[model samples]
Target chain A: MNHTIDDQVLAIGIPTDLLSTTVESLRAEILPLFDDTALKYSQVGKVHLNLCAVNMIDSAGVNFLVGIIRACQTRKLGITVTVKSRFVHRTLLFLRIDRHVELVVAS
Target chain B: MRVVETHTSPGNILGVDDDGVARLVLDQYLSRSGFRPELATSVMHAQQIIEMRPPGYFDCVITDYQMPEKSGLDLLIWLRSKDPCLASIVIAGAGEKDLVAAALRNGANNYLDKPYRREDLEQAVNKAVETTRHRRELARNEADAAAVGHLQRHLLGGRNLAIPGKVHFSHHPKRTAGGDFLNVHPCPDGALLVLAADVSGHDLKAAFVSAYFQGIVRGMLEKSTPIDEVLSFFNHCLWSDWGDRSAVTLEMPTSLSLCAAVLPPGRGQATLFSAGFPDAQVVLPSGEIRPCGVGGGHPMGWFAEALPERKTVDVPESGWLVLWTDGLEDHARQLAVSPWGLAYTLLRRDESTARRASIGDAIDDILVVAVALGSASFDEGFPILADQYAGDRWREIDAIQNEWRNTLTLAIPALSEERLCEILICLREGMLNALKHGCKGRPECTASLRFQYQSKARNLRAWIDDPGPGHGFDWASHAYVAQRDLLPSHRGLSMMHHFASRIENHRHGASLTLDFHLPEPP
Candidate 1:
C-alpha cells in the first residue's frame, strides 16, 4: 500500500492511486498524520479531505476514503470531502460514504 | 487333534497349489491339524476363493509360490492390501530362498517349504492362526473406540450454552475425536459453574475421562453441592470413585488439566481452581486483560497429596473471566509471545491488519471461554434480542431494517442518528454474509441478531449468527484501500473496520460479533 499525502491548509490529500495492495500503505501513511494533528480538528469543527487527483477508484478506494473520514469523526472531528470527479461523487454515493461525510463538489 | 479354545470359531485355512496331489495332501494335513480348510488348485482359484468367501471367513491362507496363471506373491500382495493384518503362509519349492523372500516382501506372515513334514506345516499354521486372532482383537478395539466417539458427539450435538452476559465458545478439534470438555451452567443460587477440562491424550481413554468428569459434575450440581465439595467429588472421582462404573476408569492412572470456577451470582467475585492449565484472566470492562492468579493448583491424578484449594479473584461487573486450554498457550508460542500477551492481543485485536493468529503446522485443539457477568449487563442499556430470520434475498433485508428499528426504539432511542446508522451498516454487512455464505442465499434458512448498548461507555455490541455449517477464508487479507486490482466485492470487512471498534468472527464465520465504540453525543 503506497500513497503520498500532500497536506495543505495543512490538508492531508489521501492517495490518488489506490491499488488494493497500496491502499493499506496509503492508510498507514495518512492515519498518523491525522492522529498527530487531530487537535486542529477541534479548533475548526471540521476536517477537509481532498479527492480531486484520484483519477480512478474502486470499492476499496471509496471505503478507504470513507474510513479516513470515519477515522476523523472517531476523533470527534467532522469531515468534509471535496471531490471534482462525478465518478468519485457517484462512488461515494453508492458506497454510502456520502451519508457519513459532507461532500463538497469542487467547481 | 488339539483345538485352540482361544478361537471359538474353527480356523478357516485357504490352501493353494497347482497340483491336485499336493492340494489333497495339504487338505488331509489341515483336517488333522484341527482346522477348517478351503483348497484352491491354482493361485487363480485361490484368488477367486478368497474374494468369494465372506470377509474374515478365512483366518489363515497358505499358497504355493510356484503356480500357473498367478503366483503366490501376486496373491499375497492382493490379500495383504485388503487386510494388512491377514495371516498368510507361502509355500516355496525346495531351495527356493529367493521365492521365500519374495513371499515375505509381498506380506506373507510365514512360509513353508515343499515336501514339508506334518509338524512343520502345523508349526506354520499355528503362527498364522495366532497372528490372525491378534489382528481381530485390534479391530474390535478400534470399533469400540469409534463407538465412544460417536456417543460423545451425539451428546454434544449443536448445543450452545448462553451465560448471563456475552459468553460465546468455538471449538476446533485436532482430530475428529478429542478429549476436550467445556460447559457453563448456572447454580441454584445464580452462581455459575464453569468447567473446562482437557485430558492427557486425544484418544478414547482421554474422552472417557472427560465424559466421566462431566457426569460427576452434573450429578453434584443437581444436588447443589459446594464448589469445594464439587472439586472434592471431581478429585475423588479422578482419585477414588463414586459409581463403581467410574471406579473402573480410576483403576487406570489418568490425569486432566482444568479451570473450574463458581462465579458469584451478582458480585464480581469468582472462585477459580486452575490445575496444570493456563491461568484464567480477568478482562476489565475497559478491555484491559490481567492474569487472574499468580499461580495454579496441581493437575488431577498424579499424586494423592496434590489436592486443589480454592483461590478467589475479583471480576469486574462489566468485565470478563477468560479460561483457555494449554493449546492456546502453545498457539501463543507459535506467535513468539507470552500466552497472556497473545490472549490480550486476541481480545484487543490490536493487529486489525494482520490475519488472525493460527497454530499452522503445530495446530492443536484449542478452547477459549469467557464470561462477562451481569444479567443483560451493559453500561447503560440491554441488547435487543432478535431471533432467527429468513435471510435469503435482498427484499428480506427490509424486515431486518424494520426489526432493527423496533429493537432500537424499544431499547436505545437516545442513541444518535449517526451512531444508529453505523450500527445498521454493520448489521447489514454481517447479515449479508450470513445470507450469501451461511444461508446460501436460500429463502428458508435464517440468521439471528443481538444488539447490546453501553451508553455509559459509549459502546455497542452486535452478535450475528447463522444456522448453516461454517466455512473458512482469509479474514486477514481483506483490502483496506480501493483500487482496480482490489478483489471484487472486497467491501464488507473494510466497512466493518471503518464502522466498528472490533469485528471478531467465531465458528468459522458462521457467527460474527462486532464491538463499536460510539462517539460522545453530538
Candidate 2:
C-alpha cells in the first residue's frame, strides 16, 4: 500500500490481494495514515483508495474494509474506493460497504 | 493500368497494299511521321508478317479494302482475334459506304478512303498507335498478376505431410494476389504447427510482406525456436526495424493479425497463440463448438510489447481445432452467421449451402485451418477447459478467476460483459469457499475446475470439485442472513445464489455444478 497526501485528500493504492494471508499487513500499512498527528493541521478531509489492482476479496478482506469505513466515519472524512475489477466492485456492494463509502467502477 | 503515350516515338506500322505504287507511297508517308512501316503485298502476306513477330510488336495494321484473296475487313477480323488489343485501320473506296461500315464493325481502329490525303492517313495511324500502346500495357499487367497468383497458391497453399491429426485448410483471395497467408509446419516432436496471418492491406506489397514473414518463420522454426519466441522476435522487428522505416517511407504503417496453433500427437492438449486474431474454435465429436483462447491480443508490429496470448486447450479424440484470421469473422459477421460455423463448413467442404456461395465472393481474403485430433469416434462430453488448484495457494484465486473469465468469455462470446462478470463472481466465491472450508488450507488438498459447453442444448456448465466433503451449512439460511441482516460473513453465498442460474450439490456436497443458459446463435 502506497499513500500520498495532497489538497486535503489522501490517495492510497491497494494491492492485488485483500485475502486472509495479506489483509493484516495492508491494514497495518494503511490505518496509521488516517490518524497521523502531523496531519491535524493539514486538514485531510477525504480518503481515496485505488483498488484497481485488486480482483478478489475474501471475508477477512471485507472485515478489514469495514474497519476502514468505520475509521473514516469516526474521523468525519468521506471515503471513496476506485476499482477496475467488476468482481471487487460487486463484492463491496454485496457486503453493503457501499453504504458507508463511495464506490467507483473505473472503465 | 498505365496510360501509354507514343508521342515521342511513333509506333511500328504494318502497311498492306496490292498496288506497288500505293505501297511505296504508304511506306514513304509512314517514314515521314517517325514510324517504321513493314509493307506487305496482300492480306496473306500481312498475316505472315504479323505472325512472324510477337503479338502487338506491329502496333498498327493498315490494309487496303477490296483486296484480292483475303479482304481488308477479313484481315482486320483476323488481327482482332489474334491480338484483341492490336490497332487496325482499313483503307476503303471513296464510294463504298458499306465497306467502311463493315470494317469498323470488325474491330478496325479507323477507316481510310481510297485516294485519301496524307494527313488523314497520318492522323489515323497516330490514334491507332495510342490505342495499341494502352491495351498492351493492360494485357501485361493482367499476365503479371495471374503469374504471381499461381506462385502464391503453390507456395502458401500447398498440401501438408501426413501427421498425427487430419489438417485441412482453405484460402480464398479476393484478388489474384491477396494479403492473407497460411502455412503448416511439422514439428520434430510428432506435432503439427499451423500459422494463419493477414497483412494490413490487400495488395501486392501486402503479399510480399506476407511471403517475407513466412520465410522468416520457416527459417526460425527449422532451428527449433519456440513459436512464442519467434513471435516476440517478429514483434520486435516490426516495432523497431520496420516500424521506423515504414514511418518514414509509407503513408500508413503495416500491421499483421496472426494466430498459431501447436497440436501434438494422440490425446494431448493443443496450445494456441494469438496476436490480434479471432479466437480459435474447438468442435467436439458431438458438433459442440467451444472457443479456444482469451483473444484480444495486440497485433504484431503495433507495439513493441505486443506479446501473443497463449492458452492450452483440450482436443479430445475425434475432435477438431479450427483456426482462422479475422477476415473470415468480418465476412461471416456480414453474412449473419457464426464464424466457427462457416469455418467448420469450409473444412467439411459442404458446397450445397448458401454460406459456401457467399464465401466464394468474400469481401476480404479468408484463411481457415481445421485439424482432427484423432481417428476414433466417441460421443461423450469432454471438458473444454480444465484446471487444478492447491488449497494452500489460495492467494492465486485472482489468477485462477482471471483464467476462468477468459475461458468462459471465449467459449461463449455471446455472453454479455455484465453477465459474464456476474457469473465469474459466482465461480470465484465457490472456489474460495471450497479452499477455505473444504480443503482447510491444507497443501495436500486440491480442488479441480472444469467447464463444458453443449451447443445443441444451448447450455454452459461449470463444475468445482474439492477433496474434502463440503460444508454442511444451509446455503439458503446463510443467504437470508446476508440479505436480511446485511452480514458480511455470508455475503459471498448470497452473491453466488444471485448470479448463477442454477446450482446443484452432488457427492454429499463435495462437488458443485453451475449451469448457465445460452442465447440462440444468430
Candidate 3:
C-alpha cells in the first residue's frame, strides 16, 4: 500500500487482507508522521481511504474500519472510502455499514 | 411636582371662529384643559377639517357664532348630519339669543356667550369633553368586535384546492362567522374522502367549533385512519368537549350534523357515516336526482357512546354526489344567497363551475358540496398528482400503492383481498425498477409514477416514468420467467404481467404501464 499527502487530503491506500501486521505498521510507522499533535501544523481532520486494490475484507477488517470511523466521528473528522469492487460494496451493504460510513463506488 | 397620569389620551377639539382674538382665547383655554385643540377661522374651513380628518379622531368642536361666511348653526347642521352624537359648544355675541336658539336646534350640546367668564368657558368645555369621551369608547369597542369577525374569516379561508378534481363544492355562511364547513383528503387505500358538517346554530361559537372539528378530522385522515374509526373518534371528541345539552328555551344547544364518506376513485362506490344529517342524494348525469342513503343517525356529541351506521352507496357512472345542510334547501326556495350562488349551486350550475352556489343573502347558515363522479372527457382522465422522489422513497411509493388499492377495494369490494395485494406487488416492482435501474442506484435521483382508475370502466392503470437512458429490456424474452425456477436477483416480470390484464412497456424501458381489471362490488 502507498501513502501520500496532497494539500489537505491524506489519501491512504489500504492493503488487501488488512491483517494485524499491516495495521501494526500503519499505527507505528505511517500514523505518527501524519498525526502531528506536537507541531502547530497537521493534516486537516479529513482522511480518504483508497480501497481499489483491497477486496474480500473479513470481520476483523470490518471491525478495524468501524473503530477508525468512530474515532474520526469523535474528533470531528470526516472519512471517505472508495471501493472499486462490487463484492466489497455488496458486503458493506449487507452488513449495513453504509449507514455510518460514506462509501463511494464507481457507477 | 406631581406626576399625574391621565386615564386616557386628551380629547381632540376643533375650535372655529372668524374672530382672531376669540379663536386665540378659546385655543388657550382648551389647551390648558389638556386638549389637542385646532383652530379654523371660518365655518367652511372647520367643515373641511372634520371631513378630511381621520375618522373618529376629533372628540369635540367649539364654534363662535356669526362667522364671516357661515354661521355656527350651519357647521353644527353639517356635523349633525354626519354624526349626531358629536359634542359641540356654540359661542354667541350679546343679544344673539335668537342665533343661539337656532344653534341648539342644529344639535349643539352647549352654548357660551362672547366675553364669557373663565369659569363659564371651563365648565362648558368640561361637559362637552365628558360626552365625547363616552362616544369614543363605544366606537372603539365596535372596532374591536369587527377585528374578531375578520379573524374568523381568515381561519376559514383554507377552502382552496391544491389541485382541481372531479368533485366541486361551495360553502356560504350568513355571517362572517357561520358554522358551515367541508374537507377532502386522499386515503391510503386510494380512496378520496369528503366531509361536510354544520354546527346546529349560526354565529361565532358554531363557526369556531366547526373549524376546530375539521382540524381534528384532517389529522386522523393523514394517519390513514379508517372511515368508521374516523367518525367514531370525531363523535367522541365532540361529546367529551361539550356535553352540556340542557335546554335553552328557543335556542338549540351546541350540536352538529356531520357526514363523512370514502369514495374509492373510479370504483363507483362510496362508504359513508353520518350523524344527525339527512340522506345525501345523487344527481345523475341526465339531471335525475335519487337518494343515496335512507337513514339519519344521532347528531354528533348527542351521546358519548354512539356508532353511526356505515352506509355504502354506488354512484352511477359520471353521476354527481350532493351533500348539504338544510340551508341549501332553504336557499333553493326564496332565500337570496351571496354571489357564489350563481356559479356553483346545482340548479344554476353547468360545466363551467361544477360546485354549488346559494341564491340571495341567506339568513339561515348554508353549506353545500357537489362532487362530479364522471368527467365529460374520460380519454385524458382526471390527472392524479404526479411527484418525483429519491430512490429510497420506498415508504412513499408503498403508501401511494396502498392508497390506490384501498380506493379500488372501497369502490368495488367484491375483488378478493389477495388479488389486490398481488396487483400492488406488481405495481411496486415497476417502481423499484425505475428507482434502481433508471436512477443508476442513486437514492437522490427521482423516479415517477402515475395512477389512473376509471371505476365506470372498471379498470386500474398505472405508469412508472424514469429519466434514464432506456434499460433496453425485452418483454418477449422475460415472458417465461414467472414459470421457471428463477434466481432471487432475476425479476419475475412474467408474474407482474400475469397479475395485470394488460401491460405495456415504452420509451426504451424508461416507462411502463400496468392495467388491472376490478371485480364487481359485492
Candidate 4:
C-alpha cells in the first residue's frame, strides 16, 4: 500500500491483489484528513482524491466509497475518485453512484 | 439359402447415379435386401422423377457427389430449402474432407465414401428418418407459442374506453391485472352496470381470481340475475376454489369489496348493490350532494357462508350516481377530506366561466389544481389564489375556456342542470374558506373537496377539508347573527345553510360535511 498527499489532494495506490482490503483501510484513514488544518481551508472544487490503482471492489468496498462521498458532500467539498477497472465502473454505474460523484477512469 | 422377402415402404429411397452400370448394381443390392429402391441415371432424370411425383414420393435420397450440372450438395440444399424437414445422404467416389464437411453443413443427413459397406446405407436411412420426425415436433411448438402471444396481448391490453360521467376512478394495477377490478358494461336492457371489486391478493394468482369474478358478474348481469344472487354465487365460487388454497393465510380475509349500480338507459332511476366498498353518492339537480349507504356485509369471494347486503337507491331522473374504489377513498382521506368533497369542488369549478375556460384547453387543467393543493410545495396562500381564479394565473384564459367547452361537451350526458349548479356553489365557498382561513400565509397548507348525491333521499352532500385546524368560529351561531344583522356579506353563510339540509364538522376542523335534499320528481 502506498499513500501520498499533495496540498489538499490524497492519492492511495494499492496492488491489484489487495485492492479490496486496501479500499476498506483507506476509507477509514481518509476521515482524519478532513480534520487537518491544511485540508479544512480547501474549497469545494479544491478537494480531490484518487483511487486509480484499485482494480476490484465488492459491495462492501463500494458502500464504503459511498459513505466517503456523502461525508464530503455534507462539508460542501468536491471529491473525485479515479477508477481504472471496468468492473468498478460497472458496479458504480449499477448502484447509481455515478450520479452523485465525478468518476475518472484512468484507462 | 432361401432369402426372406421384405416389403419396403413406398418412396423409401431414391438412388441416383450417372452410369447405367451403377443403376444395375443398385437394383441387385435392392433385390438381395428383399426391398425396392428408385433409380435415376442423371441429375435431370432424378429431377424429372421428383416433378412427376408429389412430395414424400421418397423417404430417403441417396445421390453421388460427382454428377454433371449439379453436385450432391446442390440437390441436398434444394431439397432441404424446399422442405426443411427433408432428409438426404451423400455418396462420392473420392472422399474429400472439405466436401464432406460442406455437404453435412448444407443439411445432408449422412455422407459415405464410394466403396461403402451395405450396412452403412441401412444405418444412414434410419438416422435420417428419425431427424425428420424431431424437426416436425419443434415446428408445432413454435406455432403454439405464437398463438399464445396473440391471446395475451388481446386480453391484457388497455384499450377499453372510459365510460362517461364516472368520478374518482383509478386502476393502479399492482401487476398486469390485480385482485381489484372495475368494469362498466352496457347491458342488453339499455342499462349500464358499473362494477367495482377487490379480489384476494396482489399478484398474478390474485388477477386470475379477479378475472373469474368478472366473468361471473358479467354473466349474472346479462341474465338479469338479482344483485343478491350475483354476490352469493361469486362468494360461493371463491370460497370453494380459492379460500383455503390461496397463498394468504386461511384466516386471512380473502374477499372482494364491491359496489354495483344498474343504471337504466335514458333518464330513469338506477338500482344499487354494494358490499364492503366505500359509500356511493348522487348529485341532485340543485347541485347538492349526499351519501347513500347499503347495510354492510362481508365482501364477495370471502367465506362460503358470507352474505352480501343489497340496497336499492333510485338514481333521480337527470341526476348522477358516483361510485368509487377504495384507492379513491384512501386518496381523499390522505388529503383530509371525504372523496365526495373533491368531486364536488371539481364539479362546481367545472361550471365557472373562468374554471370552465381552463377545462376547455386541457383535461389536465382540473388535475393541475387538485395536484397543486395536494402538493406540499404549495403554501397556504397559494390555495387561496387558486380558489379565487380556480387555476394558475399564468395559463391563458382563452385556452382554459376552450378546454372547459370540450369538458362540458363530454360531461353533458352524465350531468343534470340543477346538480351541476349546486356543486359549483359549494365548491366556490369551500375553496374560498380554505384559501382565506386555512392556508392564509403558509405555502404548504392544502385543501380538497368532494361532492355527491343520494338519489333515494333526494339529497346532495359536499365534503370540504383543509390541512389547517377547523375554524374557531361557530357556524350555527354565526348564521343566526348574520340573519339578524341582514348584512350582505353574511348572505353566503345563510345561503349555504339554507341550501343544505345539514352541515357538520368532522375530524376536528380538518373537514366539513354538508348535505342538501333534492326536489321530488314530477
Top lDDT hit: 2
Candidate 4 ranges with C-alpha deviation above 4 Å: A1-10, A13-26, A29-48, A51-107, B1-11, B27-36, B41-48, B137-186, B189-522
DockQ of 2: 0.12
Query: Could you tell which candidate, 2 or 4, scores higher by lDDT?
Result: 2
Worst-scoring 10-residue span by lDDT in model 4 chain A: A14-23
Clash pairs for candidate 1: A1-A22, A2-A22, A7-A11, A8-A11, A60-B482, A61-B482
Query: After superposition, which runs of candidate 3 have C-alpha atoms over 4 Å from their true positions?
Result: A1-107, B1-10, B20-57, B63-66, B69-159, B163-165, B227-230, B242-252, B294-298, B307-309, B335-360, B376-522
The candidates' DockQ values read 0.07, 0.12, 0.01, 0.01
**Model 4 Cα lDDT, one tens digit per residue, B312-373:** 66555544565555554454333433334444344333445234222222211011111110
Q: Model 3: per-residue lDDT, tens digit, B8-102?
A: 85678899998888888888988887778999989889988888998767878999888677888888888887876679999888999988888
- Residues B1-522 of candidate 2 have per-residue lDDT tens digits of 556544566888999999999999999999988899999999899889888997568889898998888798888878778989988888878789998898888898788887878888899999999898888888887788777778888886453534323667777777788778887888889778888888888778777788788888989998999998888988887778776664456456678888888888665688888888877877676445667765666788887787888888888777767777777777765654445445544544544533443765678888887766676211223344555678876777766666666555544556766567667667777888788777888878888776666656667677888988776677777765554444446556666666677888887667888877666655
Instruction: Tell me how many clashing residue pairs each candidate has.
Output: 6, 0, 20, 44
Highest DockQ: which candidate?
A: 2
CAPRI class of candidate 3: incorrect
The Cα local distance difference test for each model comes to: 0.67, 0.75, 0.66, 0.55
Q: Write the per-residue lDDT of candidate 1 for residues A18-42, one digit (tens) a residue.
A: 4343477787777666665545643
Give the range of the ten consecutive residues with the poorest summed lDDT in model 1 chain A. A1-10
